[model samples]
Target: MGRRSDHSPDELRELLVLSGHALMGERGFAKFSAREAARRAGYSVGTIYNVFGGLDSYLIAINSRTFRQWGAWLEAALIDAPSDRAGRIEALVRAYFGFAQNNQNVWMAIYDHRIDRSIEIASEDDAAREGLTSIVDREVASTLGLNDNDARRLVRSLIATVHGHCALWLTGSYALLEEKDPAGQAVDRVLEILTHHLTPSES
Candidate 1:
């Protein structure tokens, strides 16, 4: 007879999610494996699908959880930061850098993940993906005195620039920046430009 399943579906699912998180946090998405996740969770490879449908589905769930956790970290970072707009934006940038450095594997997994075009992304998953951006969007709107659309556009631009710079740091392109600390310098320069451009001028 087959070995009996010891855990309920909910318990098993939770176990698999945690195991997947830890595994991906070490190996990153490129080398991730549902089989490895199941093995680590003390379940058979097939049992993972019995819970999550497939590897992609399982990863989507994992990525969603990761984003929510990251949002919490960013939120915590902002709490004691200065109340001024530039200071807050600077805090946000520094928080991103810290998160990326501290959780390199999981942080990269967020961007490294690629979903099938035919797959329907759950609304919660999309919202989770936007968690960090929503924080930036709010501050950008208030600081720049921008309307919703303009603030959103500016947020996207800022994310692209920061992400690109961070990517260079991750890829060891330090020489590309004319500074000792490429990532910090990039963030500082961008924040400086944003503050200068957005500050109200005296008549």
Candidate 2:
């Protein structure tokens, strides 16, 4: 039986999200069940729709939480990283691989859950994404001496470049291709781009 008044509205919202996150981590997106998540939280499935609008919004909330966690993982990785361009970038890439591998289910859920473009997620929910982007943008800007806007613009493709390598590695596609040192390849490719971006005087 589900509890009726054990938690406040805010607490219920948080509990549901935590419950859903754990389920996503356990089942990934393909097998995740909203009913199961609510059941774990000692609530009815209708409570999820009532509190979060629908399954998609609840997932957006979960993914936003994941973004914050990923950002923190990156920060932790930098704690022992060398204070240099290549080293910092390498640390970021390795952290990306480590986090995604260690938490593949939840990590993949971040990409697997889809929503419409026009739907509005609250600003606080997006703050996590902004923090993750800020970390990458800062590193890229520092390495290449680019302004904030330019660095942010470039960070998109730069992230994709590394993500392609990491994703392939995770799914074992790299092994199928017999690719060696994919992480090293991604790091070197990034460094090559940074080196090529030198100003006329430096070049």
- Estimated TM-score per prediction? 0.86, 0.91
Off by over 4 Å in 1: 1-6, 173-179, 196-203
Provide the global lDDT of candidate 1 against the true structure. 0.78
Q: Give per-residue CA lDDT, model 1, range 65-165, as digits (tens).
A: 88888888889999978997667777878887778878888888877878888987778788998887888777666667567687788778888888877
Candidate lDDT (C-alpha), each: 0.78, 0.84
Question: Which one is best on TM-score?
Answer: 2
TM-score of 1: 0.86
Worst window of 10 by summed lDDT in candidate 1: 194-203
lDDT of model 2 at position 108: 84
